[model samples]
Target: MPVIALLLLDGVPGPHVTTPGVCFGTAARCHPRVAYEVRLCAAPGFRSAGGPGAFGVTTPWGLDGLDTLAEGDTVVVAGHSGHPDGPPPGVVAALRSATARGCRIGAVGAGTFTLAATGLLDGRRASTAPGLAAELARRHPAVDVAPDGAVVVDGPFHTATGVLGGVDLFLRLITLDHGDAVAVETERQMFLELYEPGPDQGVRADAPLPGDALGPTLGWLEARLDRPLTLDDLAGHAGLTVRGLSRRFRAETGLPPLQYLLRARIQRAQRLLERGDEPVARIAARTGLGTPANLRHHFQRYTGTTPSVYRAAFRSLVTSLTPPREVPPPGPGGPPAR
Candidate 1:
């Protein structure tokens, strides 16, 4: 398996040390086959220094053990609790050598500062924790500090905004290694769902929708999916202008209102295709897609398969779930009685 070297520094927080392991380790299990091997490595000068649950982490590998990092392997730098000056010179050299050998680099939380110190982030766009972005920008003049992104990927480096962002980054890497299906299962195992806008914005699948602002509007829209609804209708229903409604929809769902509506229609069509034997024409009409060709276009665009093919696949899956019934043998010259 490909290996991921999770580098921890002295005084690093516990989550920074553990989150990468859990995320990638769980991904390995969730995949049909193991995706990557995770190795926890502490700097040679590592001395855990913090309070409560975040202190005194033990690791089997130190900076010296980074010999295992090879081309296509990953090196994740965890944030330290001390000033963001950087890790030991030995650790920096090891990271630089590993990068030269074609290993991908990642920084979590304030670890971006350490990676920035190596000058690899020079002229690269990266984001750190929300509060530390300013200091990182001030300290590293050449690095393009992204103040608001949860996860920033520029070339061979990946930088995350916080510990949870670390989880997202690993999951994204898993998706790149495996596929979206494996990543979805992995996220499910973590009791989380992949939020399109990234979780740094605090939105998640299981979390309640933005009800106070859009609940009534959503209900109004759902009740009228069979009818043609425009942006003006949505804005008027929500008592907002078009621009205001668009902004609120983007904030809540990470998409424009029309885009969300299109997704919603496709989802509804998917349910009908899976659970019922409705014709594509009827489904299309009911979902306000107007015509079968239009439904097929949008359906394939969103789901990557034609409506008929999707229905066949769903039916095949449903059939596999049901056991076959046994039939009695025929008696005499005639068939057996019921």
Candidate 2:
């Protein structure tokens, strides 16, 4: 089982500690094969804060829990009231050490302040609680504070707002470690007991179309992900002129047809790299990238890392660190429709 160390610092709210445990623990109970052994550890200076006046907090582990972040382990820094300008000494060192050791590091709420203080998030895109994002950006010029999103996954580091956001992060991790089917099952269980909606239930209004009109064409393209597709071919299949196809495709997918194909190919490449043992060359062929060299170019362009590095970081559970991947900036046109 993968170990998840919850690093608790002084003045941390109680929920920040328990939420991850509940999320990972429930998933573990449901699927032991993908279970995480959660360890709540007291940082160099841990104290309970932000709970009900009558409540208190405690943990069984301390700095030694940092050791659990060996290969497939994760270390999540719980939010605290301590100085963001200067977090506790041992904790910063520990976080840096964990990064070097290939651990997937995460911060929650104000805990992002501590992460920023460590210089790990420098040049990486991250998100914190909405109210704290600007402050984090102001404090760390190298860290790009994402304008929106409750959960943000860069490379090895993940960050979220608070308890609910942490849940989103854990669910994502579950999907990465297991698969969508298992993640969906676990999510259904969470909702059955907590009366909460799953992530799919929350849709953004400004998001791209669900491909209603282009559904059949979208399905055709996805089914032929390995094909050497082209704009003219797509237009022919859709029974429309190239210009007409571009207009409707952009209207629905919010991306030009070629760009959309690239995204889809890269997405497929990522899945194969993470869950399969196929060689990079073979994956490239199957994803229709033609060659490993070409695959590397587009993979790095979109995910900011090579397929090998991405696989190493996630497949091994935690062991490689690469810069966070960026979403492709918006462009024109979109995929084919029929």
For model 2 the local lDDT of residue 23 reads: 82
- Candidate 1: which pairs clash? none
Candidate 2 Cα lDDT to native: 0.74
Candidate 1: regions farther than 4 A off: 49-52, 192-338
| TM of each candidate vs. truth | 0.56, 0.56
Per-residue CA lDDT of model 2 for 1-338, tens digit only, reads 78888888877776776777778767765543455788888877666655533245768888888965786688888777774647876878889999999999988888888888889999898888777788888989999998664678888999887645377678877888877756655654554342232232211111122436766676777778899999898888888888987897776655677877777787688778867899999999999999999999988876667788877766444222222557665556854443
Tens-place lDDT digits, model 1, residues 72-184 = 89998887776455667687788889999898998888889889888888998998887998999999999999977478999999998764537767877887776675665
lDDT of each: 0.76, 0.74
Winner by lDDT: 1
Best candidate, TM-score-wise? 1
lDDT of 1: 0.76
